[model samples]
Target: LTCERYPVRRLPFSVVSEEDLASFERIVPGRVVTDPEELEASNVDWLRTMRGCSKVLLKPRTTEEVSCILRYCHGRNLAVNPQGGNTGLVGGSVPVFDEVILSTALMNQVISFHSVSGTLVCQAGCVLEELSRYVEERGFVVPLDLGAKGSCHIGGNLATNAGGLRLLRYGSLRGTVLGLEAVLADGTVLNCLTSLRKDNTGYDLKQLFIGSEGTLGVITAVSILCPPKPGAVNVAFLGCPGFAEVLQTFSACKGMLGEILSAFEFMDAECMRLVQHHLLLACPVQESPFYVLVETSGSRAEHDAEKLGGFLDQALGSGLVTDGTLATDQRKVKMLWALRERITEALSRDGHVYKYDVSLPLDRLYDLVTDLRARLRPPAKHVVGYGHLGDGNLHLNVTAEAFSAPLLGDLEPYVYEWTAGQRGSVSAEHGVGFRKRGALGYSKPPEALQLMQQLKTLLDPKGILNPYKTLPVQA
Candidate 1:
């Protein structure tokens, strides 16, 4: 099968023969899947944007099985695509050609959890939400959280170095993920799974695989440092009359409640319209040009509530906020958070999505969306912007009834060039999967790109791991 939107010729990798299938069956037994019906879902990505046509899928249960599968595949010079939850927004987790699909679905197991240090050691396939519940019961919380937590695997999160709502408080996975175990292309297991908080060991080998998008190695297990569950949590959804007010309110928030602030997210009025129209979710606050979601987590309920109230009062009195609604109850908090978290789902229901995740200087974060809206309104259904305002990331999305080549042409180099002009990142939290591979140069210099290629060559000399993804084509 050929990818029409992103055309690519098949690479010169060895095709899977009967002997390969038999060997895979011997390794995974009943877990080798070749039926067309069974392989359909794993062939596509979460955004439904990319599809692959792999003939085999292997479900490995343990690290040993993963090593054996890779070792055999490497010996035969077969391309292997490592898959986790398949919840990636980019086309990273799926195969672009007839590569062997190595899935971690059966590797879901929590090995250990230290109650005092709040370190969680688990197999790669453990679902993020499941791990969250497991740690919450033990008075701790997973350091990261996103809309796809219900289905996203911790392995995929590490593969992308995912940063979600709690990132403002807990920071990125690169810091929280203290150690990990990964299997290289030659089936050598790099066991670095340690739970230590401090280790000045010569080289942090785990960092190489954290955001490599499964190109360097297949992550088998992870040891992450979880933070203690806060005693109190509060969410406030506020409406701003303009983007200036939204920025002012954020400044006020940091000045007043920075210590306990957990998240600061903002969305345009268009995003609110889509969520309300498609998801049937009611907005918690009054109608306004912009909206912001503020969350606070702290040790004492009364103290956190008082601080949030003071921040809100100052924001409203200073004309930084026009209307707002606060939630302390669990049910209400979820409802409020849904308005921001479910924007991706709502956009999907609208039509084809041209999704772009970038990091810009806070002052110019929303300008790209405004420029695009003016440039492509007739052909574009909606051009909206929203993301983790605390971290200066923008999720600029455009929708239409269907994908159009001309529309994509209008978005490409323009968006990348604008982001580059502002000295911003083109991929942001989303790793450089197939879709963004060619755009890597817009974010990194020639020297950096050359070093990345050297590293990819060093790790997988045969280029058998997740080929046609991440790195850009060389000149």
Candidate 2:
């Protein structure tokens, strides 16, 4: 039998009996879902590629309910997959077998907000954009923003340690996320939700669950530090002559714009073409070998505009950028961002996508893309490269007419080997889901991986939480 189809062996602990179901129904009336048809939507991932056969989907409204459900599941040896907005790129959000899914969808409540400290505390299932809207009205913005903001949950963001468009200016969740409350594998509630900026107390335990991908626990609540919304913003889309010019333009902009520069995103000609052709979005810049989207946010409109214009002037004067378009209005800014944010969606529409999110030295970023393109050769229709250039993270995506074993084989060791050679990370923003589990050794040493395994064994002796996911099997 397949690993997933293996029959469950009854344990000594209590199982979900008819009476237990009755108790669950009474506790959270009509919230627990058992219908197969209704559970189908949550059984799959955002990619529509990975599917799971979850028997039950629990929507717990309060942390107490979550605690109770997990306590029962722990004793019953029932594997649980904690789902957020279900927008994860990897199959981490969905179940691999017949595990029960515990979704935080009903726990979408804002607990508290401190305007003076710019700290916002909300339930784990809260949609990212909803929190952004709530804080934006209070003259503050969430430290992080991404294309999936409309669908991804704050809890998912914390789980993945997502680095998005705003990372260039506002920094990562590691710095912005103040505290987290997560339920352990054995139903122990870990409440470390402190809003304090500086805490020199013992081991920073919250960091463990930040990027654990729900293997260690289910995050119940999140306390994040928000940044004050910029009073004015300016966006400029520039088409560079080549990768070399793109780097030069970035340096020039960094020097000229300094702290005001919020984002420095890069895209190649093929990426822009895919976005234009697939999404029907008009390209803002003239044809070029490469394109860059530069953004500046500051307290004054005139200052932000001047900073962008000054940087552009220097870039054009130095031949770093060939053509450009600047946007001052909010409508135009959104239009420009759509070109960058929608590239992933456009690529998805093309064909089967093999996605790789890697972090290399900023200087060697273009080399990896160029090398991968040469290695893929003819069968791979297109190998496009783009991502948060400022953070030295590259989203190297390959699109093919069909998924082929040969294509995957050629890219696997070569890509990971190249990344490791440069003292870079194999998985940058995306966590080591099933797709990248085998490549964990490329980024992490044997000693570190051993420690990780030790911790995993200590936390989950039964291996019930997200089994066969993040960690790789021993040789």
Candidate 3:
């Protein structure tokens, strides 16, 4: 939440004048909120790691209103921060300074849903969990499911290119989002809201704004392809003696379960201990160095159970797994899945948490956590490792008495250097917000970085959109 230490200098942009406030009022009069109390929440991030001092917040209910606000802001050189759910981990959602907040809270509405093709088009501010429930009633499933589903807006998920629990099977938003409608910097509405699965007419322009993190434009609507809800689902929690056994178990599950494998997640004993101590959630299986949670969904319950049972038997028989528990009922399935999803909630109660969601080579995934635990045992409260093992994404977190400078100094260039040595990405699911913006060079080449800068310039010429985030500071 400290902004004084952050290195980025504020751009020389026009402040929101009385005239500017009046113009925003013209768009949505009652929704223009400038009260200090209400503005405090949107000014800070979900993790409470960053804060902004924006004086005005505008809530636009329709795409045309959003376009009008952006176009006017563009002409006046007034910086705007487009916000959806504001549940982002990195400092991407909150503003760094006094930029006018352009919120999509009032824009929540389901536009059209074709049950036959399983395509749903809705306003960008729709809450992800609400959409899931709405589609579930119609026998369709939203492709992306995350821990923040209850609060995270679908547009915010698309903005950050969120890769949640379902990515192992449903894939990324870049593939699931078929078309979108965005308001450019000049208020130009680029509507590519196509429902067709195959549209090769011209260049796919909507993909640019999908993961751009509100830098290029304000996404007002999204057209995503929703998959049908699977008839049968099962979850299994297993204990492994070591990381090697976890790997072997993963291989066996993939080879045997094949198509129905929904998610494959792993966590170390440290994570479980913290969850039990802080959150009072007991582990299903006995204590082990490692644990795995496997989920399978199919059309037939009996067939899925037989396949999962066979995989469990092979894993137990081959010594890949030491102990396990299975759940087929909905309530039990949710109870088991909560152990993996609630790691974030549990960490919040401990103390200030330093999180690094990185994508590393499978072999070197846990090495960073091990090295940190050995190096800084006294100063560091706990070094926990747990994440989506199926996609080689490691959620490495270090809890401490407070945010210590020495701990960060030892971890930073050290972790980035280690991941870079293995040709890994510094960020996996969490985008490079202000927290990790400087580390982009480690994962990107000079040529690629230049091209990204070029795109930013071409789209948002004035850089009035969410600044001091996404791309690294200009050299």
Write one digit per residue (lDDT tens) for candidate 2, span 294-339. Answer: 9999999998898788878888888889889999999999999999
Model 1 ranges off by over 4 Å: none
The 0-to-1 C-alpha lDDT of every candidate, in the order given, reads 0.93, 0.86, 0.90
lDDT of candidate 1 over 249-301, digit per residue (tens): 88888988978999999999999999999999997888999999999999999
For candidate 1, what is the TM-score? 0.99
C-alpha-based local distance difference test score of model 3:
0.90
Model 3 residue 102 distance off true place after TM-score fit, in angstroms? 1.2
Candidate 2 minimal-lDDT segment of 10 residues: 5-14
* Superposed Cα deviation of residue 164, candidate 3 (Å): 0.4
The predicted structure with the larger TM-score, 1 or 2, is 1
Clashing pairs in 2: none
Which has the greatest TM-score?
1
TM-score each candidate: 0.99, 0.95, 0.98
Looking at candidate 2, what is the lDDT of residue 230? 94
